[model samples]
Target: MTQRIIKLGEGYGDVFELFTLMEAMPDRVDRLLALHTIKNDEERTSLACIFKPTNQGNFHPIYICLEGIPKPNDQRNKRYEMFKALSEQFDKPIVEFTVPPSETYHEEEQYFQQIIAVLRLNHLLPPI
Candidate 1:
């Protein structure tokens, strides 16, 4: 299968925007993955969420969130919690990463490259 990488930005409410987009194209999603960046290095706060395709014909939408979730040093992160809850509700694992942000790259493109790299490294994405 040919996999396409999409870059998401952090606008006023990009999370909500992403949700709305996925809701609109539920069937097109083969899997959902997310990467959330944290602020501090104490606990290592990067996270990745994955959604797998089911036999029941349900949609699998991956969400890769970066620079969104606040660090534990600050107030609790509702957005991170929400993604966690959603994963639990859908029986998916909220995978975590602890890598630094991409260097000398635009936010959106960098995010896309990161996700695609992860998928390829994990053998989740077929050679294209």
Candidate 2:
């Protein structure tokens, strides 16, 4: 199956767009993931939604909001809070983990490829 990478803008505004995509296709939502990483010595999170592949096509699209949310609970970030709320609304728990920052990779594509590998190895995503 082919997986499409869709990246939206950062911060709270972009979160609305992510929610809208989910709202439009509740049944397509397969799972949620929260990737935690340390960037510039601060804890950050990347919220992602892996939607099911098309029944008639070999496309599995993952919508991700990059490391814009603060991971610390003591720090209030409405964007993360909104995502948390929606996760509860859909009853899909966020599968979280700490990973190497994007800077560690030579390019953004390499970073995402690593993530896909992890997802497939764990069976969150099917082997192609």
Candidate 3:
């Protein structure tokens, strides 16, 4: 199985798109993630949703709104609140982790690979 991160924009509109994707395929939803990080001295969160691999294509796509929302612990935001509501609707707790910010990586793909490795290590995702 191949897993890839598909980044949505980093803004409110992008978050809406993420929610739309979830609503469209609720059955395929595997995990809801809140990746917390400190960037430029400010705490931010990346909201992501992992879907089960497609039956025919075996492609696992992780949809993400990267570093867009304020960390819930620091300040509550409407977008994060919407995510929380989705978590409730889906009956999945949002899994959270503190991770290196995207700036730590030379390329965005490297950053996503690191996150995939972490998920696999924790048994949240299947191992390669």
Best by TM-score: 3
lDDT of 2 by residue, 6-69 (tens): 7775575677888888889999998888889999998888888999999888799999887867
Which residue pairs of candidate 3 clash?
Answer: none
Tens digits of lDDT, candidate 3, 16-98: 99999999999999999999999999998999999999999799899999998888874668899999999999999999999
Model 2 residue 9 distance off true place after TM-score fit, in angstroms: 3.0
> Cα lDDT for residue 97, model 2?
80
- Count of clashes in candidate 2: 0
- Model 1: lDDT of residue 85: 64
Query: Tens digits of per-residue lDDT for model 1 on 13-39?
Result: 655555565455545434445443433
RMSD of 1: 5.5
Candidate 3 local accuracy as lDDT? 0.93
- TM-scores of the models, in the given order? 0.58, 0.91, 0.96
Clashes of each: 8, 0, 0
For candidate 2, the per-residue lDDT at 84 reads: 80
Q: Rate the local accuracy (lDDT) of all candidates.
A: 0.50, 0.84, 0.93
